[model samples]
Target chain A: MVIKVENLTKRYGDLIALDNFNLEVNHGEIFGLLGPNGSGKTTAINCILSLLKYDKGTVKIYNKPMAPDAYDIKEKIGLVMQNVAVFEELTVYENVDYFCGLYIKNKKLRLKLVEEAIDFVGISYYKDFYPKMLSGGLLRRLNIACGIAHQPKLIIFDEPTVAVDPQSRINILEGIQKLNKAGATIIYTSHYMEEVEQICTRIGIMDKGRIIAIGTKEELKDMISSGEKITVELFSMDNKILEDIKGLPHIVSAEYRDNSLIVRSSKGKNNLVSVLDYLKSNDIDFGRIYSEPPTLNDVFLEITGKELRD
Target chain B: MFLHNYIYRLKCIIRDKEFLFWTLLFPIILATLFNFAFSNITEAEKFTRLNIAVVDNEEFRQNTALQRAIKAAANSSGDKDQEGLFNIRYTSKEEGDKLLEDREIEGYIYLDNGIKLVVKESGLSQSIIKGFMDHFMQLSSTLETIIRKDPQSMERGILDKAEAAINYLKEVAPSKSSPDIVVNYFYNLIAMACMYGGFWGLKEVTVIQANLSSQGARINIAPIHKFKIFIVCVLAAVTVQLFEILLLLAYLALVLKISFGNQIGYIIFTCIVGTITGVTFGAFVASVVKKGEGVKIGILIGSSMTMSFLAGMMYDKMKYIISTKVPVIGYLNPANLITDCFYSLYYYGINTRFFINIGVLCVFIVFFSLCTYLILRRQKYASL
Candidate 1:
């Protein structure tokens, strides 16, 4: 295991930030901790990094206990915070060089690593620019370059794409994948289910300081009974038709609004076919029809009874 | 590693324009304004010999002792180096009256049973003349009493002895340098500049504590020990602060022509110590306050300004007031101690007082550093 947080618990006065939180990230998997804004994702990351004091339990990295003074363990870990953390006084190249120097002592090797990190983030053109002179997207890229310049064995990105523009967000996600391919284990945290679904090999859905579910995206989708959602555009639909569609086999719920009949069904291979057959049998006039596999949001909603973004 | 961190830290501090403006340019500008405001008063304070007349009556002529004293005073006026107390003109009583009334002389001295001084009004020059006459009369009276009690005592060279005693009683300055009261303001300005170094110290602490800033968090996550980074950052702060102080000192001495005495080595030493104290004080404040960086900075600035004010940066007499009335505060305040170091150097040369001030400043540095360490040693924060 690259990171093993067992029964970790932390409290801020009466509020529990992490309650018996347990997570084990393997050597080469992109483990995503998915949660909403205040779901204790950051608190758990801080605890795991030994940047914060936990009320109970332990965090181990690379089979060694984590601590504030654990230099050996810390040497192999890189952290890109949710907020941009580069020095405003330093230029892009200088900022990267300063942070990289912390880990790599050799002047020649540090220089090369800083240049590569800046290029990796696609910010080499703005190397001479100070952080304040850069746009928001470029500043975030500079922050990433500073964090990843030393090329540690494991990297933790805590909501790195928050408030980022779409283009930069895609660029950052792709960079993480490249780092993973380069053999660094990654721990990515975010509330954006699409982001986790897009890159994360395995994800833990967190709510109220606890992981409600943890599995691969496909496995998580399978945990929920709700499966494919079928929608059919109709000129008009009576309540009788909607109730009859709801009574179909494997159909969990059905509703008609805005001249469309939307039906949610339990996991079944022929659910979409059954919904279409019922629509034709009722002689319902339909224009367009489509079906979507269950999303992470649906799995979250089914398990937690709340939206992922809540 | 230390050198690498120190170099980058130095670069960051040097590029902080707002901090540089306050720590470097502000003192220079205030010194220039002070020079403009004090130049005229300093010039007016230069002493000029007072003019007085002696009535050429038989009483004045018969008094050979008074004649010799008057001749000596007149002779001393001819010398360029030593200042003369009086300019005497011998005239008839009628001419003496005319000179006094016409304002040609400040006062007329006539030997009536003893020396009597007449002046138009009471002022510094008039008071000086009266004081001189009173001393002469008192010495003459004492000599007469001694002669009447022991007539043969004169053969023992009593007159020469009295003259030697009078010469011994003449006022002597405490130091070779001129004690310009206005120079205290410059000392206070330098003290304020030293305290401004707290800003650099504050910045160092702000950027190193994970709970304080995101940059701090990033630094905390690094493999190196946090204290190592802190030491490097403090070295950078001290280096920049010392350079700024030396630059301010040079501006005051060379550009503004303000003399802080001839003790160049001691002045630099004081600046070095003051810079360290300023930075350490800032770090102490940053560590103790559980607030945002803005609040910590505000407190540092407010505390520094208050210390400067109490040390007489705003009013010269305030330093004396604090020193005499609240002596503990005078000894405890770092600004006051730094100011006194320069003040003692200017007025007393390198004496025990100067060493005492320097010692107190060193103590302040140790105290601040210890407090900061006590507060920051936890390493891991309960919250960020």
Candidate 2:
């Protein structure tokens, strides 16, 4: 395992921030911590990074206990915080060079790494620009460059693309994938489920300061009763037709609303074809139809009630 | 790594306009204002020879003791060319009245019963003439009592003591150079400038504490030792502040024609210690105050200005009052120590008092810096 956090518990006053949170991220994989805004995703990351005090637990990185003074571990770790943390007074190049110099003391090596980081983030054009002068997207890019300039083996990105533009978000996600491909273990966290579903090799869903579920995207979806969501555009639909469609094999729910039929099915093969055949046999006319496999959002909603969002 | 941190911190501080304005431009501007406000006041206080007119009468000519006292007060320098406490003009009574009316003589003395003094205006010169007459009368009375009590001992020590009394009044001559009152403003200016170094110190502390800023959290996550980071940043800040102080000193000495005496080494040493104390004080405040950076900055400015005020930056006589009334505060205040360092060097020469001031400032620097180190040595924060 690249990073292992076992039985972590942290409390803030009367509120429990992390309740026995356990996670194990393997080498050369993108592990995403998915949750809502106050679901202890950041609290868990902070505990693992040893940035916050935990009541009970152990965080081990590279098979060694993590600590504040563990230079051997810290030197090989890169952290891109949720907020932009680059210096406002220093230019992009200088900011990158300064953070890089923390790990790489040699001036020449630091200069090279800084240049590479700026180039990797595609912010080479704004190397001389101060952070205040850059737009939000460019500033976030600079923040990433400052964090990753040293080319650490274990990188943690806490919501790297929270409010980024689409193009910049794509660049950041692609850069993260490229870094993992370059032999780094990445730990990603975000409340946006699609981003995690797109990049994460293994995922953990957290709520109320605990990881409620952890598995691959397919496994997480399978853990819930939702299989596929099929929606059809209809010209006309009767109430008896909808009840008959609900009676089909593996049909968990079927409803007709706004001149359309929506069918939610359980785990089964050819559920969409069975539903279409039942609709045709009833002489029900349908327009365009869409069949979407169960998403991470469905799994989250099924496992934790939607009321958990604050 | 230390050198790298130092260099980058220096670059950042140099680029910071707020630091530049506070530590450099503000002092220069304040000094300029002080210079303008104190111009006429200082000119008026310069030492000038006092003019006096004495009536030429039989009583004045016959009384040798009175003649000697008047001569001692007038020709204090014992030289005809140099000016003294009084420029005496012996003239008729009518002419003396005319001279007093014309403001040619500040006052006139007439020997009527014992001695009488007249003046058109009551001022320092008139007061000096009255003081001279009083001393002569007292000496004459003492001599009479000594002769009456023991005529034999009158020749032993009474005449010598009376002669010493006449010599004491003659010591107030134009021998020593007049003290410059305006230099106190610049001395306190340097003190205030040194205290401004705390702002940079506060910035350094806020940049390293995880609870303070996001940049602080980012830095805390780095592999470097926290103490090493603190040391390098403090050194860098002190260096930058010292440079700012040097620029202010140069502006005062060269541009404003303010004199800091000829003791170049002591002046530079005072600034070095003053800057260190300032930065260290700022760091101490940053560590102790659990509030935001804005609150820490407010405390630093408020306390520094208060100390500067007590050191007489606002009014010159306040320092003297504080030194006499609240001597403990005078010794404890860093601004007072700094102002006294320059004051002692210029007026009293390099002596034990100057060294004591330097020593006290060193103690303050070490005390504050040690408190900051104890608070910052921890690598992990309780809450980020």
Candidate 3:
């Protein structure tokens, strides 16, 4: 294991943020910590980084105790927190250079790395612009560049894609995969289930400050009883028809909204056909339908019970 | 790591241009304005007369010596000789009283049994005139006795002096009475101006902390220690502040012809220390308070004003109140210390406890600095 967080616990006065949380991230794997809002994702990360004073925990990075002044250990780990941490005064290139300078002392080498980091984020045109002048996405890219420019062995990106446009989000995901390919152990956290499914090799889903389940995407799908979600767009969804569909044998649950009904069921068998037959018998006009296999959303819903957002 | 942090901090300061202007430039401009406004004479100008009023209720009118003194006052060459500087006018007792009440003259001298100076207040020019007249009375009395003793010509000596002066005034061009105190203010004036504001802690409170354009958030992270960052910033800020001090001082020296002192190194050192003290106090303030740009400004204005007030920078209208009631604040205020230090250096060739002043201010700087560093080190991104 490259990173070991053992029996981690933290509290704020009377409120408990994390409780006996244990996690291990091995080298050469994109590990994901998925959680809802206020589910101690940030708390755990902070404790691991020794940014917060955890009441009880032993965070071993590269198999040694972690403390703030442990510059040798801190040297190999990079953190891009949820908040953008670039200096508002510095231009894009300068921001990257400054942070990289913390680890890399050689000026010529640091300059090359800084330039590559800027270009890698597709923000070369904004290399001279100050952080205040850049748009939100551009600033986010700058934040990532600052964190990853030092080129640490282990990189932790906490919700790096939040509030970014789709194009930027795609670019960020691609960059993360590239960073992993370059032999960086990545710890990625996000509530976006599809993003986790798309990139994370193994995901740990947490709730109420505990990891309820951890496995590959397919393995997590196997863990959850609900295998697939069928969403039907309906022209007219009658109250009795919706009730009758819910009463159907293999149907798990049905929700009607925006002229659509979402039917979820365990047993990946074709329940959509049976539901469509019932809808036809009931003379309900429906639009297109989409059947997505059990995503991380299904895995999250199964373990947490409540929706991840609540 | 040090170089990285340094570059990053430099960048931050550069990006925040509005902050730079307010913190660095604003206080300087305000100080310059105060310097010029409070100055009695920023430049040399044409000579003017000292207005004096006389109300003599004596039955001693035919005193030729007194008449001669009065007439010759207009034509006397200089105040040092007690004959040339007064604009004398005689009025009735009631008229003098009314004129005093109406502020028509600075004061009036009444010569009865003894001389009495009647005015709203005693000022510098008034005291100088009072001394001159006292001497003139005795000199006239002396000259009168000498002439009386000769038994040759029955002439009062003052009458002869006055007649001769009046006759000379008709033939010769006038001369100015330049007082020694007025002409001798070139001593350590530069060091005093530069050393006071910074030593007083007004610049820090007013400029760096109060300028809202400089954000505190950008610095809390960035993988660098706060103290090193602080050192860089303080060094940078003081360098600018001391340069401004030097600029104003040079303008005064080269242009206004003001001199600080003979000991050039010590004078400049005093200014440098004062600048550092100001920058340190500013950093300390920034550490303690959040949302303090306005409060910092308030302190800046209030501090410079109060320091100037206590240091006798303006009219000494509140000297009685400041000296007696609030002796501690008035006597020990840094600007008072700085100004007095320079004054002592110039007058007595003494440097009073420069080490002590620096040590005391360093205590404040360290105490506040440690607190600020602890607070910054424990910074939080969220409200918690």
> lDDT per residue, candidate 3, B98-198, as tens digits?
88788777788776675567777888667867776786777767666867777565443444554453443343322222222321222223323443333
**Tens digits of lDDT, candidate 1, A40-153:** 999999999988999999899999999988999988989999999988888999999999998999999999999999999999899999899998888888888888999999
Candidates in descending DockQ order: 1, 2, 3
The per-model lDDT (C-alpha) reads 0.89, 0.88, 0.68
> Candidate 3, residues A1-49: lDDT per residue as tens digits?
7899888988887888888999999999999999888888988887787
lDDT of 2 at A263: 92
Worst 10 residues of 3 chain B by lDDT: B206-215
Docking class of 2: medium
**What TM-scores does chain A show, candidate by candidate in order?**
0.98, 0.96, 0.92
lDDT of 2 by residue, B276-327 (tens): 9999999999998999878888999999999999999888899999988989
DockQ of 3: 0.39
DockQ values, each candidate: 0.69, 0.56, 0.39
The list of candidate 2 runs beyond 4 A from truth reads: A234-249, A254-261, A274-286, A307-310, B46-178
DockQ (0 to 1) for model 2: 0.56
Model 1 docking category? medium
Report the number of the highest-TM-score candidate: 1
**TM-score head-to-head 1 vs 2, winner:** 1
